[model samples]
Target chain A: MEIITSSKAMQERALQLKKQGYSIGFAPTMGFLHEGHLKLVTQSLQENDVSVMSIFVNPLQFGPNEDFEAYPRDVERDKKLAENAGVNILFLPERTEIYPNEPSFEINVKNRTGVLCGRSRPGHFNGVATILIKLFNIILPDHVYFGMKDAQQVAVVDSLIKDFNFPIELIPVETEREEDGLARSSRNVYLSDEERSQAPHLYKGLQKGSEAIKKGEVNPSSVIHIIENYIKTNTNGKIDYIEILSFPNLDTLEQIHGKIIIALAVKFSKARLIDNIILEIHS
Target chain B: MEIITSSKAMQERALQLKKQGYSIGFAPTMGFLHEGHLKLVTQSLQENDVSVMSIFVNPLQFGPNEDFEAYPRDVERDKKLAENAGVNILFLPERTEIYPNEPSFEINVKNRTGVLCGRSRPGHFNGVATILIKLFNIILPDHVYFGMKDAQQVAVVDSLIKDFNFPIELIPVETEREEDGLARSSRNVYLSDEERSQAPHLYKGLQKGSEAIKKGEVNPSSVIHIIENYIKTNTNGKIDYIEILSFPNLDTLEQIHGKIIIALAVKFSKARLIDNIILEIHS
Candidate 1:
């Protein structure tokens, strides 16, 4: 695998590949690759002639109190995993390479927020949108992949691509879960042993929530209460929020009558984990 | 020339051409054809396999009191001129098409914006950056052209392209002038005959300021005073501002030592005119 550390070199390579008629599929990650991130890479490999993966732990996306400083980094392991997965280019740009100075311009995300994880982390999507713009311009991929475990991020990416007219297709892969149904995430490394044992209940709570919505319990508050009860009984982690809103748009529903998502965030001893399930509704 | 109003169709067409290994050169303008605008189109034609021109009088850039509604536009004349100059695509998207609704996202320009036209028109570069982000993504051009009549705009775009890592090359063409020294602008149409004659003095004043700096006068205020005095004496228009600042970065200089710009804006009775000259200063 070719490792690129310079933004200019990466862009030149992407542009050259583009001129030569090779389709590139990109998966951007924040190092510390897990099975879920590797899945995106493997899928991109299947879809395109060239598969490019980027690992930049962007500080722009993290809030003042969030995990910018403490975010996991195992670059050696990440590089080996990326090489084993057959990534054509593994972009590991230094912080200065990505942001030599404070950014002079920024993209403010104004939609598909106000619910779920977005509600808890202000400026999170804005930072994500900004970094993705820089990456999309640099990578110039034909298609980009995202794991639906970070479903709000996927929705933000959808809006960024559509609204800005980025000529790349988005491939949203389903969430990769553990045997006990815990959504796989790098932040999972921060979980204490006891918290790790209880983490599976977050997904189970979401499943119960989905099941209630699938059946006739239609009031959003009632459905939220059912899941809240499930997690409260099974786990010691604090529920940050459990919201039911229209899918992708994340708009509030008077009564759920279209595609909707039941999503939640829980703050355990040291890590915050989020998960969601999307379902379509019949009139 | 082929004209497209749909953003999606234009992107698809640009992408297809790109896949076929064609280089596209783009020039974005507000309508009202003139020799200056045609210069950009003809230059793009020379530089690339295809030339794409867009006429969008972006409302986002205009302040509430600025002349957005009254911005001069002549589609028929522009179409004929662009066709005569051999443009391959003329994208004329409606305001609603460019902005289907109030934008849920935006690019806020934080630098090179506290001087010249940017100082008077806040959020101007922000809007320009937002729209250009859309256009660059949609057109997928190899090179984009801009006239130096709006030098600050050229500077802003240069930063936008480099900072965002946009793959497109920016070709900053020298300001096209008439038999007289007046910078060609669509806004010149709003000038009364007297104002039309006085507008050339704006350029001439910038010339005098440059000549003084070419000699030993290195103080920014003195150079600005010289230009301001010339404009105040020669024209009926109100001298809005005349500033001498470091080039491109638009930073204030204690004493001009490197590349510098003598920029001015004059508000005529009915029209506002702007002009500038960039100079390389030693010691």
Candidate 2:
């Protein structure tokens, strides 16, 4: 496996590989290697001639008050996991490498970012979109993988790719879970023992909400109510938000007879966790 | 040459050619092709295995009060000009085809657009940056060409490409002009006979100002004064603005020790014309 530390080097390698007709599948991560990230790499490996992963903890994507400094990173462990998972290239660029100077333009995301984690962390997805533009150009992948664990991000990226008419295919991998239905995340490590146990109920509440909708619940507020009650009764965590919106678009639903997402966030003692379930409804 | 009106078809053709190792050179333009547009195509054709030209009168770049509806377009004429100029593919997507829906994101350009035409026309470069992002993704060109007649646009595109790290090279073609030194433009047709005769002074004024700077006039205000006097005395048109600033970055100069641009705009009876001259300074 080739580990590239320079963006220019990565781009040059990508250019050469592209000219030689290699189909590259890329998964961009912040690099605390987990089953969630490997799942993307696993699928990427299975689908393309080459699998490329990027591990840059982008400072641009974190707000001024957010966990820019505290974000966990372990490049050596990430490299070993990438190698074990059969990734062909690991791109690990520094902050200066990604942004040699302050940018002159802003790719302001005006949609699909008004709810969930996006609402709480303003300017986050704009930063994501900007970094993705840079990464997309550098990597030049035929297919890019994004996990649905950060479902809003997937939706925002989908809008970006569609709105910009990018030729690359976006492959959204499902959220990897801890078997107890708890979504896998680096933030999961911040959870205390009891908080960890309580966290699974986040997913459990979502399941109940979606199941209720699947059983012909048409009102979004009713589904939201079901979720609110389920979580309140089951978990010790403070509910951050519980919302039902149109999938991908994230627009308020006038009716539930369309593809929708039941998403929620819960604040535990030490960690704030988020999860969602997207469903297609005919009624 | 093939005239593709569908962006999807254009992208598919681009994809096929790229996979087969054909390097594409692209020049995007608004229709009513002039010598300025052809010069870009001429270079593009010379540089790559395939030359792709897009004729899109992007409404996004036009302010609500600006000449969007009055913007000149002649696709049939443009198609002939492109074919005659040896362009391989002519992309002629309709406005609806380009925007199918109103964009949910805004690629706001915050720098290098504070002066010249961008200052008077807010959101113009943002729209330009946005459309270019869309076009770059669709065309996937190895090299993209832009005429330096609209020097501010060239600078903004420079920022966009640098900030996003687009792998495609930006080739800035020299401004094509008439024997009288009037910069070639479709809007030249709108100039009255007297206005036509006086319009070349815009370029002449810029040339004289740049010459003064070359001969060691360090103060930007002094340079502006020289150009303002020359244009006011020589032309019957109204002097809109005369500016001397750092080139490409368009920042106000603290010292005249680097590349700088002397630019101006003139409003005649029926049309507005702009011109500039860039100089490299060492002392």
Could you give the CAPRI-style class of model 2?
high
TM-score of chain B of each: 0.98, 0.97
Interface RMSD of 2: 0.8
- Expressed as tens digits, the lDDT of each residue in A131-178 for candidate 1 is 899999999999999999888998999988888889989999999999
RMSD of every candidate to native, in Å, equals: 1.2, 1.3
Cα TM-score per model:
0.98, 0.98
- Pairs of colliding residues, candidate 2: none
Candidates in order have lDDT scores of 0.90, 0.89
Docking quality class, candidate 1: high
State the lDDT of candidate 1 residue by residue for B85-190, as single tens digits: 8989999998877888778788889889988888899888888988999999989899999998888999899988988889989998888888898988899999
TM-score of chain A of each: 0.98, 0.97
Worst 10 residues of 2 chain A by lDDT: A65-74
Model 1: CA > 4 A from native: none
How far off is each candidate at the interface, as Cα RMSD in Å? 0.9, 0.8
Please provide, for model 2 over B1-283, each residue's C-alpha lDDT reduced to its tens digit, 9 standing for 90 to 100: 9989998999999989998999999999988999899999889988999999999999999999888888787877888888998989999998888999889789888888878898888999989999999999999999999988788999988888888989888899999999999999988998988889888888988888888888988988888889899888988988778887888889888667688888887888777888888889998
lDDT tens digits, residues A127-182, model 2?
99999999999999889999998889999999889899988899999999999999
